[model samples]
Target chain A: MGRVVSAASAIRLDDVTLGYDRHPAVHHLTGEIAPGALLAVVGPNGAGKSTLLKGLVGTLKPLGGRIDRGALKVREIAYLPQAAALDRSFPIDVFDLVSTGLWRRRGLFGGLSKGDRATVAEAIASVGLSGFERRQIGTLSGGQLQRALFARLALQDAAVILLDEPFAAIDAKTVSDLLELVARWRAETRTVVAVLHDLETVRRAFPETLLLARRQVAWGPTSEALRPERLLEARGMQEAFDDHAPVCAVDHAA
Target chain B: MTPYDALVAPFVEFDFMRRALVGSLALSVGSAPIGVFLMLRRMSLAGDAMAHAILPGAAVGFLVAGLSLPAMTIGGLAAGVAVAVLAGLLTRTSVLKEDAALAAFYLLSLALGVTLVSLKGSNVDLLNVLFGSVLALDDDALFLLAGVSSLTLLTLAALYRSLVLECVDPGFLASVSRSGGPTHFVFLGLVVLNLVAGFQALGTLLSVGIMMLPAASAAFWSARLSGMFVAAIAVGALASLFGLLGSYHTGVPSGPAIVLAAGALYLVSIAFGASAGLVWRLLPARRHRAA
Candidate 1:
């Protein structure tokens, strides 16, 4: 674990292959992310962008090789999965949900101090949910719910922030406002890894990119990583990878 | 006689009625909050599963000790926890879902309890185990109720925050703290303990009613968890009182009477509760027209 990462590097995946039940979603990926560097994991769908993010966040263990979290301890990294993974019907209010970001410091069963409460309110205001402080989370629209989740991430203040498709299928205004938060996080020198598919947005907002199609295609400046030919090759590679047939006697999944 | 006389006179006259009221009240205070969490977490049926699971343990106690309170209680707690843990394990280790696994285990327990009771006991004794003898609660049963109630309240107060976070977003809680897994198990343990507490007052079949119906009804009224907790306790206490009174007056079985009273509250709440009730949902449009 020690040799796999360093304090200078925020993350190092030494030929890591992430999978479920031994079938690789992300296979044989080697990369070292420097501290304070923002990397956009650009990929086609099913190209293991989320699987890679989950591996980085320590939710999924690497199937082969290793992923050293560098200077980030498990708690120092904040990962937000897709909204569908969250239980929206949960009977919690906006204020309390945002306040849970302070969990790393306060732990479970600890109450918020007066200053901490003010910070939570400020974070809520930052996310444009001021009047919704008391609203039950179940009642919020998808975009508003994302804003509330982003408010929680703001309070987390982790050294490493990982977001899985935070801007997918939402209003443009929400995407822009949340993109601003991402930019602010980068300015603060936090290592931010975002799984992004919108090519134009990725090209405009992200400086560094790692384009993955089950394995590393190209990783460097966004200008080189998202070149048209590389994207076409990624598409071809994924399609060809899917074309191979492994026949089974029954549909076990069904 | 005035309405107050009709309500108050029975308790004033009968010492057994007074004792029954006290026992049910204690059951309400301890178990209602647990019910609220179970409802919010969508583990309401899990509480019922645990309630049924305690039957075999209590039946075994009855078989061995022949109507001793402590023996039955110890047996009930053991059976309840065993079912909870086994169901959890089955869900984890097998393809069976949590609900399916729990249903399988509880049904097995119920069948076992019934068989055990019938083998060595009379029909009257079997009836007592299935529907409790709340009117006949002795000093030992009263002491057990008080003890369980105290333990439930103290444990809940300590675990409330962990339990709430676990309910809302277990994955987030896991990312943040190491307490998530332990909190979940401790909560299940509390569920078993609370079920065992309520079982003596309302038998295995009826005990889960007091826990779930009040909480489900409260969900229609309060959007906030804290508010729902308070609402559930109030609803439970009212159900207990009214059920006890209904039992005394109409000659209905006490345990089922209490459960039916809670069920009645649930139906009323579904129609008239403030938050998501049927009538409540209809009121806004009517008010707008009037305005």
Candidate 2:
């Protein structure tokens, strides 16, 4: 019942280097995310999975090489930061919170039309939060809040959707429900990239995977990228990395 | 005393009392909602800091213009915005957090302001700047209060949606639109403007009282932002009315009386309000039927 328009485009990363304080966190990454691609980014803790998503969402600028979005504006990309970044105690309800997704459509001053209200309701129902419309978001459990966030993202109607640990700490039922929504996005030819920890969920739901440990460990089909040896290599690489290392040389665009 | 003799007669007989009531009512409409937003943003004390930050500027204005409304207001606005911007810059560039930076600047500002006020003016003038002369509000001051109230309401209406998004999920708003940072700065400007508006009737020290007391009290009664806004304005207006009357009858300072009235409401709300009030905690939980 929800028909939100999303223009499709491929995202190209040419030796992208993302970092803080000139220190590379996710360095020397190069790849193209084709339109309608459903990809999972897997890594150990501090392996720069979240950093990569930040780079894609344009919150963090690449310290070295460029990320080419072709023609997509940063506003047209939907990003769900980790739950820790959210302030749940702010006084707002489920329906109002979800309607914030229409920011790009309605903008800073435009009022939501009748059709827009119906679309918001549909998005809420799709997330199984039909009756919780008037409930304050602070009262929502983590899973329910995540579902509400997904509903908000659905209304964003963006070409590229990036999520940082979207299913972390979620129940299996909630994870399954959210995954179905992700699949529906893929069916609509929207690009979906998620930072994930659970290998089992990745193997089941994602066809393509980028296994990373501050650098690309493997990038291919999920089965090949998540092989046992590659995972071990990722872990070893993460452990051997020095936290106090000096800034690395900047990459010259090839 | 009869109801008319006690409540109605003070305002009817004394022109100054009527002016005081109208001035504070304007403050209630303009400043209280800003206070609600401040409370929601978890920046309640930040409002207090900003109020103090305006002191040195207003003091300078007083020194130069001898209590001219325009001079003191411009000075107060400049000082408040300068401190806000400086503190914001420090938070961005250094390890100092926004609160710590603001505290440091405002403490110095309060010292400078008081020193400036005491330089040329008498103790009475110092008391006027510190606690306000609400009963002596001139036409210029009244006009300033009304203008600021009208402007604050209009600006808030235009910025409502973005302000909500900025408060609840700043990062999300930053992702989708460029309004997040600009909206926040504008909200801070509104806070300073309201405080400036209130300073004439309530003074720099006590002005924030009218803003914060009612807003914080409203939190006890409601969870919805709209409800909180209504409750806060109601509480503020009631406090202004009673405080002015009480001041006329009791021979106490009017500014503190008004603020104290608001404080009393806040305390009462804490005990008996509808949402998470102390009384609710003391009562037995209501049973919910299983579906």
Candidate 3:
């Protein structure tokens, strides 16, 4: 078994192609994300943004190539999937739900210690949901549920964190608050990659950007990646791509 | 009649009544919480499907051993698990979704079971296998019921967190740990085991009724998983007790009596339960001062 690495580790994508059943959703992507890097993945709808996040987190294995997490074990990477994938109607309160973040550390059978309880409470408080600790997750508003999810991420204490559309459809106030939490992760020297939609927010807060549209359009500083022509090219590529295209010849040979 | 004469005297007077009560209460202890999870996972009908899926296996065992306990138990368990695994595989490998695949297989299994049971046995034997004879529980049947109940409780405790995580956010659980798939199968195994336990008392047809009705009623009373577990078990126990008494007094079959008792509670909970009963929904909302 690999020793769990809590310290930050660089994730290297080596000509990675990820897709479903030989149809490439995101392909031929090569990039190295540095430890402590705050990277935003910006792409249009159906541009495989969420797929990229899945690939990074090891949930979706690559169809070709490999994602090399230098020293990070599986548990050392915390992933927050889209809220749509979550079952909000489940009978769980915010505090218990957030405590699930301690899973990697405490594991299946371990009881939560007093300090762990304090940490859970603190995580909830940090998310501005202190008063709603006992509220059932089903009762929470979308923004509040996002906050609770962010709180769970805080408790994960992983070397790397991945968020899929953490702010989509969320209110402005909650977005800023969660962005602050992201900044805190960066300050703590953890790798943070978020799938983002708002170009303005990405340029403002994200130091690095990977602009993708079924393929890498730009991978560099946010300013360079978000350039107008590159953005237009990404949009065009997405619209023009054929879903029924045969397996990639390049991926086949490699 | 006095409450004691009506409720307490049946168990005190008849050995069969006591045995039936003990058998069913034990079955409920194991099965009701499993039903709660099945309900939470929105696989309530899947439980019914699995109950039917076990029938052909039990029928085969009956054919080979003439209603022997171990043979039928093992056969039913094997059949239930096979169906669950096959349905899961079909969902992954084919276009059909999980529920549709399950329904398809269970219907086939049900038809096969009835045909097989009718091959050698009379209609009485067939009805016995279908509706169960709770009042005629032998020592072996009682022991099986207790054993399955104890195992279910222990397994539920051991796997509670993992099972909860699997139910609520399977993707997240998969991302975080490797226990998701195994946990799911274990849960399905427990479901089958409980259904088999239930088969002895409520039989294949009404076994799911004991599991689902209490769980559905519990949903009305509790908003937390732990609370629902308690409520479900309580309802299950009460239904078994009342159903047995009702059977004793009314001459109805004990199996249907137990299930009907659970169904009655479910209906009552729908109207008056604390969580989201119809009365609460219909009542005018209280005006709240601005916080």
Candidate 4:
């Protein structure tokens, strides 16, 4: 029943269950992502949002069931872990960090070719870091560091880009700029899946969405999947509106 | 004769003195890069441990076979690599910290080596192994040092980028398509080889001092990798030359003399070098007052 499909149908997860040390985080999750789609995964704290991305990226193995791609290899996927995941004291420049993306193309001993250098420069420019090639990574600000990591992702030139909470602790301007870049990636017919906590940004940016809270609550277009009833169900609230919770405006287009 | 003239005259006339000076310079240059990586990986103690572990292997070679430097060197390298690999495996499999494993391997090796040397009927040779005599260095030792240093430099130059990447971002390197296993082993092998080759001149105890001190001091001056490598080599070569000359004039042990010279450089770097040094930090404060 598995077959290579068009760009509109790229990743398919069938009955996938994943967890850490036998503790199930995501259970019986079934979904499919289309190419050129901007999908946002949203939930509250400890909602298995990051764990689902880890399972998709092959960093964390699935506990049961199968995660099948139409015809994609693991290397064709690019992952941007949390900003705090990196070692700041490491003595590497922006150029060195970005060049690591080319490791697959230029084996271990092979030097960066002229073409590779051009791609590196283009990727740096794409992230608005044109003159940051020689700057040490430890010297960058939080926003600049996030952009530098985005530059590395651009250099990876993969089909799917998976970002885990890249917008956290960043300023509003940087958030908009990063989302705009993700929109551009979608324009190029690539897949963009981000683990986001801001529901407002999720509604404004991502067309399709997955609402997760230890289990798959809803998986469909943002307008249909992020309804008030579904959100209340996912949040484990009997009453729809509570004094502490903010009201959700669910679009009915889907 | 003036003290300067007396010291200068012996270095010019003595062939053994010339060999000792050149041999120390070559060994310092070869070992410093490996030391840089070792410090970055927080495996500086492992390098120290492996250096000490080679002594028992050397003593065994000397006791079993004739007293041949090459045979001793080969035997020592084998033992050092074995210790490094075992420690690495233990750290991976067990709940032990890397430093704990290193300490255990090194102490056991040292005790075994001393016992083996005592069994060789000449415990006095252990002193020579502990504190080497540069005056006793011969043409064969010079040639061995030169050849090993050249091979190490060539290998480092070839794998420089990958090794640096591995040191800085091992997880990222592992996520990429290239296999990091072989490169990791090659880097470890280079460290083992440098330790074994330089063991004759610096001895086990002081070899790590020469390897680590120069690179550690150089980091205070430069942020660039190539700059750090160049600065480390300069510090190492200068320390070796001055230490050799000072030992010849003052009748001191060559190993301690070299270590003292390196320690002096470290002090100077900490006090005066730019970037991370105390002097640089004080400059902004002075500028604020002056402005």
Off by more than 4 A, model 3: A1-7, A240-254, B92-94
Question: Deviation in angstroms for A85 in model 4?
Answer: 3.6
lDDT of 3 by residue, B1-291 (tens): 999999899899999999999999999999999999999999999999999999999999999998788888888998999999899888868999999999999999999988999998888888888988899999999999999999999999999999988887887787778887778788889999999989889988899998999999999998888889999999999999999999999999999999999999999999998887889988899898897
Q: Give the per-residue lDDT digits (tens) of candidate 1, residues B131-171.
A: 88899888888888888889888988888778888878877
Candidate 2 off by > 4 Å: A1-7, A240-254
TM per prediction: 0.93, 0.96, 0.95, 0.90
CA lDDT for candidate 1: 0.85
Tens digits of lDDT, candidate 1, A1-254: 00111223468888888877666787788888878788899888888999998898898999887888755688888889876366778788899988988887777667899999998999999888999999888889999999999999988878788899988888989988999888877777778899988988888889999999988999999999999999987886542344344622122332
Score residue A49 of candidate 2 by CA lDDT.
Answer: 91
lDDT of 2 at B277: 79
Model 3: per-residue Cα lDDT over A1-254, one tens digit each:
02243456689999998888777888999999998899999988888889998898887899988899887777788988876477889989999989999898889999999999999999999999989989988899999999999999988888899998999899899999999988888878888999999987998899999999999999999999999999989888644457687767776787
Greater-TM-score candidate between 1 and 3: 3
* Candidate 3 CAPRI grade: medium
Error of 4 at B66 (Å): 5.0
Instruction: Tell me the TM-score that candidate 4 gets on chain A alone.
Output: 0.86
**Which pairs clash in the backbone of model 1?**
none
Who wins the TM-score comparison?
Answer: 2
Q: DockQ, in order, for the candidates? A: 0.56, 0.78, 0.70, 0.34
Global lDDT for candidate 3?
A: 0.90
* lDDT, residue B84, model 4: 76
Q: lDDT per prediction?
A: 0.85, 0.90, 0.90, 0.79
Clashes of each: 0, 0, 0, 0
Cα distance off (Å), candidate 2, residue A214: 1.3
Which lDDT value does model 4 have at A203?
A: 92
